[model samples]
Target: MGRWEPDARGRLLRAALELFAEHGYEATTTAQIADRAGLTKTTLFRLFADKREIVFQGQGELLALVTRGVDEALNDASAWDRMVNGVLVLSGAHAHEHRTTGRILDPILARSPELNERAVFKRSAITSALEGSLIGHGIDRWQAGALADLGIRAYYSGYDLWVAVDDSSTLADHVLAQITVLRGAAAQALEAAAPQPHPAGVRSADG
Candidate 1:
């Protein structure tokens, strides 16, 4: 192996995923990942904080995309539009490319409590960034938070389905589909919960 491989960071990430899937996330070590990548542990450490960081290497880029999407949304856009736009940006930025990695990481996450917790934390951070960006765009804080949460839910639900299914649709398409479904469901639930009006020309029993 050459001392300087092209795309060393990518090589490290792929190597880590392979190791994690083969030996479980909790069982894999930074040294093993480095060795698998044909790089020294120092090289791996330089590229990533640790083994866990390797799985979440795309976190910063995804969050940045969401922030930029929300910031650039039209001032008059609805909260749902702003939130969906951010999610679409994130999906477009890395969804297809990260799908395989996500598939590989999913089982590992399910087997490890620490990694699962970290994954949840990363998701929360992404939602926080989305909410902050929406708030900066003049949306109410509460609405922004709710929109961000819904966006995150849509993204994850879509990503999971996309990875699990044998479909050709892009990640952005899957996310949009999930968002539409979620919106419809929410509307249905709200309608079901709303108070029914009295019959025409008739008063309610209490009235």
Candidate 2:
């Protein structure tokens, strides 16, 4: 069961997202957010630098969860397939934990340029972390980075599509279907490239 008592931080983020969805970003103020969260304005600032940061506090955790799953699982034949498939397996594996994440992330990205920029940056970081994981598994730096970003964006696109569709479609199925599409693309892209035999040459990646 979920905790009955309020979690100040969670409440803050949820309130911010709710308000962002209801009133739009520019019009939502710290005081309004505090009122929504049942927190004082000072406490909101104590937890976040400003209103913008409120939308992004768990971003590192998101990247870490995705990257960690990919780093530990490389059974797929090609690094590209692994990256594309990671879009599903890693993200789906954590759907429960990230359930509220999309609710918060989507609206903020939709309405605020600043939040959209932050989302882009977060996507870049996820891409970089995923690329580093691929590089550790013997893929070339530039190729790994490009494909990682591609896979993440593909997942993002699929996720939005899923949301726009009926709620009957689960996020996992949506991402998984997109992962399949991405994997098909990766397989076609790598068909002509000669396989490298040097995972040993790569450096370790952070979790």
Candidate 3:
């Protein structure tokens, strides 16, 4: 029997990232990842579906956290508020501890088209989870979808900012800054798209 190991999933993820960075993602194998993590292949398979899964682990937990954050928001919270709450909740759980992993994983994904595609799927899943939560809580589907897109965009852009810089600011702080930028951009878009009244003396060709 194998002795108990704490944080096996995290260990496996870190090991996989380290290996993929040192070697290449395509050259790496599950057996090697398990071995690097100091566990058997069976243990790795128990935790992940396959080698690709190791790269995309913790998604279930993140989706659950997003739902929890949205659900826990005040009943009267706006859609933006609910989405921000979810981003905050998810980011808080990750925080600065995941930076090293991010720094390694980013380049790995960039170099591999397969991993990049998987990342997009994971991103969509999270957005859908957030959207569903908002709609379940009485938000209109249109608004929920739009807010989910915006929120996810902010979340990822914030993560990139966090990983690229060496700063003491938390992930939540970065996410909030991105949220502010997105909100301002959205406001500007709305204003630009709104109809502008013409001067009384100005008659259009169509008129």
Model 1, 1-207: lDDT tens per residue? 674878888888888889888888878889888888889998888878888888778788888999988877788888878898899998888646677777787888899898888999999999999999999888899989888988999998988988887667888888899999988998999899999987799998887
lDDT of the structure predicted as candidate 1? 0.86
TM-scores vs. true structure, each candidate:
0.92, 0.74, 0.94
For candidate 1, give the lDDT of residue 34: 88
lDDT of 2 by residue, 59-112 (tens): 777677667666656565587667765666556654543555675567668767
Instruction: Tell me the lDDT of model 3 at 200.
Output: 92
Better of 1 and 2 by lDDT: 1
Which residue segments of model 1 deviate by more than 4 Å? 200-207
Residue pairs with backbone atoms closer than 3 Å in model 2 (clashes): none
Once superposed on the true structure, which residue ranges of model 2 sit more than 4 Å away at CA? 1-5, 74-77, 93-108, 183-207
**Candidate ordering by TM-score (highest first):** 3, 1, 2
- Model 1: colliding residue pairs: none
How far does residue 172 in candidate 3 sit from its true spot (Å)? Answer: 0.5
User: What are the lDDT scores of the predictions, listed in order?
Assistant: 0.86, 0.75, 0.90
lDDT value, residue 25 of candidate 3? 93
Task: Output the number of the TM-score-best candidate.
Answer: 3
